[model samples]
Target: MVNGDPSRLAGQCAVVTGGSRGIGLAVARRLLADGAAVSLWARDQAVLEAASGQLAAGARVSCHCVDVSNPDEVSGAADQTRSRFGRVDILVNNAGILGPRAAVGDYPHEAFETVLAVNLTGTFNCCSAIVPEMVRNGYGRVVNVASVVGKDGNPFVSGYAASKAGQIALTKSLAKEVARSGVLVNAVTPSASETEIFGRLDDDRRQKLLANVPMGRFVEPGEIANLVAWLCSPECSFSTGAVFDISGGRASF
Candidate 1:
């Protein structure tokens, strides 16, 4: 009904972490529109409720208040989703943090740890919970929302960049592990996008990040969702452990 042609994800259940806002929210919306039952996972209960209310689907939506960095929390959330829908067919690891916009030498050590904890370890936790189920079912799609900085480091954001780079590596490693089990694991490395995450950046830092994109613009959340939706579909077969660069011409080599 949403797409009108065919629902590639009909009868599927997708779990999207950080689904309360930004790219995660957009991906949740698209997956719903494409007819997948969606379980939105976020750290904020109120915000997650508000996000779920934005979608008009009846009985096909759920939300989990969870911190992906916590293994127990991720496990409970994933179990709840499986309980709600019988199985989780997809996972979008979109939760992340934008660490302090300071040079590596000046970056706070605690901030660096938090960034990696959330961006990389959190992703691992989510995958740890959902991927085993996917492998059991012999079908799955995992999209790790990495960044262009992960591909090529950005000045003044070493923590953010390094964390995302770990996600890229994680994606590849997981893909190889589950390749023959009908599961596809891949990454979407996007450039600066118009999202609340950008608000975390100071103007000087934001401008420097944007200036590197040859397209002269920030990528839209919906645009990233579009690519993600397809990647989650059956048509996206034959590709795993690959980087889908949505960096607007910024990711060179």
Candidate 2:
């Protein structure tokens, strides 16, 4: 667990996409603990509502059901959030979909497209929707959730790696464009993390992947969330286009 002053984000309002589970859920919890009002967006209504209820008990929290891959839905959700919370001070683009694992030559075309649509395009959609409001306020924090595969190529997940690499590039370009606007943009790259997303992998494949992590274990979801919560805090100023790694011993750079 990471420790810091609990009131660092007082009076701030944050929106976390994919906040119903995994890293997104953890980030929401941390932000609330730090005194920020939070809104969680997810595609599943029941799950989103339940998570929102749990977080609301700790802090001011709201939930919006949105499929990041759909622009209309995301836009609508943003409108609802702004109406409910006044304005969003931090936006965490954490929603992503991982495709099936297979050699590049044998990977399914539909799976690759699905991954790109949800991972890369979804992030773009959220950024486009939120940046304008952030610019108007002259202060905002944006953290994109990327992956180590984006830095060092992973053999079987070409689509996921490519989408995340695109997100890194997006982080850099947006950072420069919005630096003067007071909107700091950065990306977090974590190695294989232990989350419900990993449940999709077969036991044999999961073990093989885990064997390569120098730390001898999958990264915890909360570990990644800690970095994201800090980056979203006001304390994280004068830093943009930065790539932070929370990959244990898996990342050397």
Candidate 3:
């Protein structure tokens, strides 16, 4: 577990989609460190088991094999999570895919649909299944891991940009809906993090992406985790329907 004030998230439980690695895994580690019971949901059982082993948090953690793109699967996993942890106080919608890096006209139709299915619809399914519980509990925190492309509109990644844009819009709409219910919903846009997602990029594309960052380095998963942890905490009480940028000086506004 990471070093932090363990009592910050004491008695809380969180559900993190795509929690097997990268930003999702890092966020899980932070939440576990902050004393929250975490339920990790991912599509791969083998990867989930490995992540669970890495965490090694014992009873405070549980792994669920779930495809966020499937509403039925999401609902079932939500039920299991509630059964295991009693309640879910936080929901992190981090399950997403960087679709083909082709121009809009050249992008494959199937790939575009798949990206939207996993990134946009998946987020919707999770929120629909879990947010009601948060509403009933009178407390919740939802963080959507969006991307800079959503706001800035990067070229040759139309599908990814569109999906993340949908997430940001969804976050705002949901946050407004539950604003009076003590449940806060927000989005974080991180520019080009050095995750497995990078495997999709060629050297030229990678360099072009890096050149846009004034910081001259990729954003780290741990860095995004820190921001997400705060957003998931009681300390982030005033913000909702907001977008937090972890873009390493890449965001202009």
**lDDT, candidates in the order shown:** 0.91, 0.88, 0.95
Per-residue alpha-carbon lDDT of candidate 2 for residues 14-45, written as tens digits (9 for 90 to 100)? 99999999999999888888888888999999
Using lDDT as the measure, the top candidate is 3
Tens-digit lDDT track for model 1 on 1-253?
Answer: 2342237789999999999999998998889888899999999999988998887676899999998989999999888898999999999999999988898899999999999999999999999999998999999999999998999998899999999999999999999999999999999999989798867677776677789899988899989999999898888999999999999999986
- Candidate 2 matches the true fold with a TM-score of 0.94
Residue 164, model 3, lDDT: 96
TM-scores, one per candidate: 0.96, 0.94, 0.98
lDDT for residue 218 in candidate 1, whole number 0-100: 88
lDDT, candidate 3, equals: 0.95
Displacement of residue 216 (Cα, Å) in model 1 is: 0.5
Candidate 2: pairs in clash? none
Clashing pairs in 1: none
> Which is the better candidate, 1 or 3, if ranked by lDDT?
3
lDDT per residue as tens, model 3, 122-197: 9999999999999999999999999999999898999999999999999999999999999999999999987887
Report the alpha-carbon TM-score of model 1 versus the true structure: 0.96
